[model samples]
Target: MTSSTDLRKAFAPTGKLRASINLGNPILANKNPQTGEPFGVSIDLARAFAERLGVDIELVVFDAAGKSVEAVRGEQADIGFFAIDPLRGEGIAFTSPYVLIEGSYLVPEKSPIHSNEEVDRQGIRVTVGKGSAYDLFLTRELKLAEIVRAPTSPTVVDVFVEQMLEVAAGVKQQLEADMNRFSGYRLLPGRFMVIQQAMGTPKSRGSDASTYLAKFVEEMKASGFVAEALHRHGIQGASVAPAA
Candidate 1:
């Protein structure tokens, strides 16, 4: 069995818990408008986990999910929140998801592509955030349609509009918000995927640390901590994941 001291050593070797936060996923995290600080469901969870380990917390923030995942995979940060993908699992040991978010596609209101299936046809170009979960998933799934990647998730729609791409793929809430920013766009009814948002530490942390983190996630869901945090953050279109 892994003792509490061993768990601390694995999680906070630098004497503080370093959490890699991605502001790209609006449902998980966002920046404070007035203070320029990180605050959201992911931030709240990071703080709570640090408190559980009885350590001070440090946020290693990034504007893109890929950068955040790299920080944890390279062990530059102790842990991070991410959408579960098999590619990322090579370096990171992920917990059962604590939040479930929808991934959807957006297109011009008059686009001939009315359904998710229609967007994959030849000559239809899609834009997604580089190194994002949807990007990874679509890379494997889309055979005929070309994928154009934006520098970050927040810019997916921007790139789509700027480049006149046929489709934009990203977090459903983000796509919905982008609809407001860029007129003449509509989301395909239903989702293309369900992104499993979870916490992860480097696989180097060992099975014990991974197991502990998994338990923590399950507890957060059962205790309604995850649900309350989402509500407090004013996030919509995401739900607490069921217990694992």
Candidate 2:
């Protein structure tokens, strides 16, 4: 077992804990329009973790998941919320996922593609946020369709529509919102992948920090803190990930 002193030393080297907030992931976080503060399940979990560590918390905000990952990897922040992906595991240590989000594709209403399997055709062009989990996954999984990288995750839908791409792949919630915001677009029947939304700390922080964080996540999930946060934040479509 890791003692409080050791946990603090390993995870909070600067005597303070910083959490990176990625607004790109609407399931985990949302920007408060009036306060301009991020408040959502991830924010709640970060605050609670800081309290457990008995350290002051600071939020380093970013509009993209890639930026948030970079913050933790570079030690600009001690921890960050991220989608558990092998590409990102190089510099960061991830805890078991606290939430599971589906990754789906959106296509124009009149498009020939009627399902997720139809997306990987010879001439189809798919758009995704540059450096996003879907972008990384599809980059490897797509056999024939060309991938057009948008500037950020939040802008993937816009870029997809503007560029008239055949498919737009991203968080399922984002696609649903886009369907409401725009016309003539519908999500494919099911998800292409499940995004494991997790918390990560710099690998330089050591295994103790990693272990502590993983245990904390399991506790949060078992104790209903995660479910309550989801309800409090009015989040839907994301379920607490099963024990990892």
Candidate 3:
């Protein structure tokens, strides 16, 4: 077993654990209305990890997943919570996912699209947050539909509505909340994808750091910590990932 001193050296070389927090994914994180500080399951996990390492924490916040991933990949932050994707894996060493979020589509209620499968046909324009996990996945998977890039994940539905796009893809909870702002939008019958949300550090952080992070995630899941965080934050449409 790696000693706490060695673990701290690997994860918090700067003497503080810098965590990249993404506010765009409401299920993982969001601002406290009263305090304007980031809060949610991811924030809870980051704080717990810092406690385990006996280090102070610094939150490096971003409004989008792409920026958060880049912070860890560039070593601007020590760790981040992100949806696992192959493109991001090039520079990030990811632990098994700690949470699983559903990716769904939102469409105007009157639209003919009734299922996740129908959105991929020709002439369909799907809007997604630029450089987001869904964007990366759809960019590779969709052969006929056109994908429009919104400036950020939280803005995806806004872009879809403004542009009169056929579909908007993102975290199911986010899409559900965005639906209330419009009179005629509804989520499709089921999810298009299951996003594996995981903790990650820069690949340059070395194997010991990666192994320790992986173990931390598995323990969190097995001990009910992940589930408790979700319930505490009032998050919906996401679940604790199975122990890995």
Candidate 4:
């Protein structure tokens, strides 16, 4: 039977890993504003996988999170580091979620946002990235806030920077990067959507290879190692629970 080593050695992901790292999203994927170095959760996961398999990982840029998924489908990336969703699972294999993630609201400094009640109290303009998971969730869950959809992730960032306001995204690292820049970022007391996050492997892999890697990922999750890695990387906001 081919082991993880054998599969990776045989199919070492070729090409510059089209790293779909968004520009402003901090914890997931973003080039450092100061050093021009890409440092984030996605980078960490990709680096770990490459090291484990004795391969190399070269990062290429993707403008947004959704584009990252496209990169994998187009054979530009071996994988992308971000939350694995059921919709995405349709054509992919994902590692067991390392951290418990949730979607919440982040507003500008002292914006009279006292509770989830204010989600609709008055002129609450919830700006969101186009085609983002948070946009989908807000569409389904939010009743009162006016959803101001930005054309892209960067557009969303620009909107928030301009208004000093916007709703918090439910995604990880992205939220940390988006909301943490200002002094007034808060988790919005008791208001967030539960979003379980996992890593993704593209659908292009053969069924045999996919199943084998899935089992391997399950084992890693069971070992409680991914949690340690997440915490080590300054992404402590993700709730780390023992492997199920």
Candidate 5:
């Protein structure tokens, strides 16, 4: 294995960094759709990367991290911000667990189910985006319950809307009604796991990239940019654990 010193030299040949962020809403990156200026938590993190690198940084925005990851994997971009998932791990290297993500089931109040555990006890179904990280996790980890996967993100939104209608019309909503009252369906407490959302070049980029970037990331962590980014975003519960 290449030593960390070697890795750092590769990542910061001139002591500068180039990174991108996902501009999707609520992602901590909200840049102009056309011009691509950095914004939000992801942008803030990028700033830290630049500051620590001691070089000018460039920022680009994408529709979402899923797309941004493509840029990183292709080497069109050096790094991108995104959520942690098994499939994404296949394509890109992540920094470390930089943030905590809390995912919960949403439904109208006064539904039959009171907690998330009750959903799997019966025949209730859950709707989620097709091929999404959440969908993958639910299918792979929560196999006890049945999930009706929507074909796309829009359809997932539609499912939520349809559920809202069901509640408005007094029918047990598919997703909008209380997870329990829709007949024992509900989201459970989000599992606590370290989702290290790290950054790396493509596996094809070779060991030099990983080795170098890894050390730079460690320095970024030690310098407190990661923690400051988390705090700036009011992410008190999330963590910035050391990846190395």
Candidate 6:
């Protein structure tokens, strides 16, 4: 168990816990259109962690996960919310995921790609967010399909439409919203992958911090704080991750 002093020393080295939040992922965070302030599950989790550490919280907001990850890597933020990926693990220590998000494909309504299995074929172009977990996973897993990376995840659908790509790979909820806003777009029946969303700190922060965060995540899941945050924020299509 991490002592309270150790938790504070690791999580708030600069006298406050700076949490890097990614606004690009709407499922984890939602920006208030009028106020431009972010409020969602990720924010709530960050706040709760800060409270646990008895430290002030500072939100370092970013438009994308790449930026958020960069902040943690650079030690610009003490911690960040990220998808649990081996590639990102090199620089950051991650806890078991507190939420599970589905990664799926979006295609034109009249497109012949009726099943997820049909996606990996010759000459099929799939657009994904550059450096995103889906991009990293598909880069290794995709057998035949060519992956085209957009500037970011939030922009993948737009890039797919503009480039006339065969498929758009991204968060299922984002694609569902796009299907409603744009005409003649449909999501594939099931998810291609499940993204494990977790909190991470710089590995250089030391093992004590990692252990504390991992335990904290399990506590939040067991206590229903994660589920309550999702319900309070009106987020759907996601569930609290199973205990580690």
Q: Which one is best on lDDT? A: 1
User: Candidate 5 lDDT, tens digit per residue, 21-68?
Assistant: 655324354445686555666677667666654556676556544567
> Which is the winner by lDDT between candidate 1 and candidate 2?
1
In terms of TM-score, which candidate is stronger, 2 or 3?
3
The segments of candidate 1 whose C-alpha lies over 4 angstroms from its true place after superposition are none
lDDT of 6: 0.92
Ranking by lDDT: 1, 3, 6, 2, 4, 5
Best by TM-score: 1
Of the two candidates 4 and 6, the one with more favorable TM-score, higher being better, is 6
In model 6, which regions exceed 4 Å deviation?
A: 1-3
1 against 6, candidate with superior lDDT: 1
Name the runs in model 3 displaced over 4 angstroms: none
- Candidate 1, residues 1-244, lDDT tens digits: the string is 3577998899999999999999999999889899999999999999999999999999999999999999999999999999999999988999999999999999998899888988888998999999999999999999999999999999999999999899999999998888888888999999999999999999999998999999999999999999999998889899999888
* Candidate 3 TM-score versus the reference: 0.98
Give me the overall lDDT of model 2. Answer: 0.91
What overall lDDT goes with each candidate model?
0.94, 0.91, 0.93, 0.61, 0.54, 0.92
Q: Encode model 4's per-residue lDDT on 86-140: one tens digit a residue.
A: 5556666666665566566667666677676677645678877765666766777
- Clashes in model 3: which pairs? none
The segments of candidate 4 whose C-alpha lies over 4 angstroms from its true place after superposition are 1-6, 9-24, 33-35, 108-113, 117-124, 151-158, 161-187, 222-224, 241-244
Instruction: Report the candidate with higher lDDT, 2 versus 6.
Output: 6
Candidate 2 has its poorest 10 consecutive residues by lDDT at: 1-10
**lDDT of candidate 4 at residue 149, scale 0 to 100:** 73
Q: For candidate 3, lDDT tens digit of each residue in 102-143? A: 999999989999999899999999999998999999999999
Candidate 6, 1-244: lDDT as tens digits: 3478878988899999999999878899988999988999999999999999999999999887888999999999999999999889888999999999999999998999999999999999999998888999999999999999999888999899999999999999988887766797888899999999999999998887798899999999999999999999889999999999
User: What lDDT does model 3 reach?
Assistant: 0.93
What is the model-wide C-alpha lDDT for candidate 5?
0.54
